[model samples]
Target: MIEEIPSEPVVITHIIHETPSIRTFEFSRRFEAQAGQFCMVWVPGVDEIPMAFSAGNAITVQKVGEATGALFSLTEGDVIGIKGPLGNGFSPEGRVLAVAGGVGAAPLRPLVTYGQADTFILGARTAEELLYAGELAGKAEDLRIATDDGTRGHHGFVTALLEEADPASYDTICVCGPEMMMKAVLGILDAHGVADRGQFSLHRYMKCGVGICGSCCFDSSGLRVCRDGPVFTGDVLLRSSEFGRYSRDAAGRRIPF
Candidate 1:
């Protein structure tokens, strides 16, 4: 078996400005990882946050929180630490329908690039926020876009586009986005009787990327997002008490959505 790598410092090789708010950081040391698995990114003195791979040695970050703000201030040659390509990833098989919202598109990018997905629907607040449309258009057999501001192909939620499509037609449906969005997608897929075909990626407060800490644990299920998943099947999510309803804070306190 290959030796498991531990947390180690890495230098940023380059950065790509995907959008005004989103950036992709490429590291000097390359590693192997599946699409949906995540790494614990340590920002030196700031904090450590879990980030999913956009590539083998790269992470796509959206400037949203304090940890990410610190990440945004760094430039090429800056140092950070990474631990694990931990948690189960999507094992997409056969024809796939991929749906993503906002920065959630980053993780699903690999699936399309590998020719696993036939259709991709990307939703954002506006046209400018739509991530990787040009790159994905050429990769996916059918690429669709939806924006809340009517600035793109479909002027509504991504869920609306999903409803229009044949959910049962695809062998697998992969999704990652805001918890509310994924929850809505699950409901739709359930209505179509294809809930079992869906796979969803979820994010929760994570202190340990190795599942030692219970910070990322799903309510009642005792499933740890850092280990058991960042990706879960539709059936598992449907049964989760905390799936879309609420999430834990840094203190492990439940915060309702």
Candidate 2:
């Protein structure tokens, strides 16, 4: 029989800086976790935040707040509470294309490890802010990088790169990035008649990683992002006005669009 997994604190055994602002945390787990899923990271007396798994074996976290800042300060053997590898993750079944922007590339790293014919498009404002270049370069069949300031490979938005990409060559696409970038990508896919063929990871402030908090809701078919997603399809996001606009925190405070 499968042993019941307990919800408890796990010790952070390693931390690796990926970029100036992004870091990856390694946690000791008794079992393997699915790629693209996240865990509720509880920093004692501070706060708990939902962070997605970047590398499958290591729980990677981007330093975005006070709680996460504290997490980055940790060294090996430091402990933190963790509840899950909860929520849905991407199903990498066939030929795929992965698009990520800034720290958004963290979660897609694990997906790259599973053998597949995949291409990755990563975007950032500058070369210094980019993460996982070496990792992605080795895993993807084709790797493309874009920067907004013309400091990198392609001097344009990632959507511009998407526009130039041969979408018909891939069987599936996965996107994770700024809401506007994903929306732009969706538009590009739609124009190519491939909108229904891709998946997107929606980033939002989530508390109580479980559904009780009601903090991560979006208007797509009455979908609750915390429960139904942090990931959804282009088709679902397109129908929702709130997908790119409104978001809330644990206290139900409206986060500015």
lDDT per model vs. reference:
0.89, 0.76
Q: Tens-digit lDDT track for model 2 on 1-257? A: 22333457777777788888887777776435566777777888788888777754466666777997888788889888777777787766667888889878877887777754378899998987877887778777789999999887899888877777877566778888888788788888878888777788887778667776566777646676666877787777777877667676767776766
Deviation of model 2 at 60, angstroms: 2.6
Among all candidates shown, the one with the greatest TM-score: 1
Best by lDDT: 1
RMSD per candidate (Å) reads 1.9, 2.7
Count of backbone collisions in candidate 2: 0
Across 143-239, the per-residue lDDT of candidate 1 in tens digits comes to 9899999998899999999988888888899999988999999999999998989999898999877877688989779998988899999998888
**Residue 223 lDDT in model 2?**
71
Give per-candidate clash totals: 0, 0
Give TM-scores for every candidate, taking all chains together and pairing residue i with residue i. Answer: 0.96, 0.91
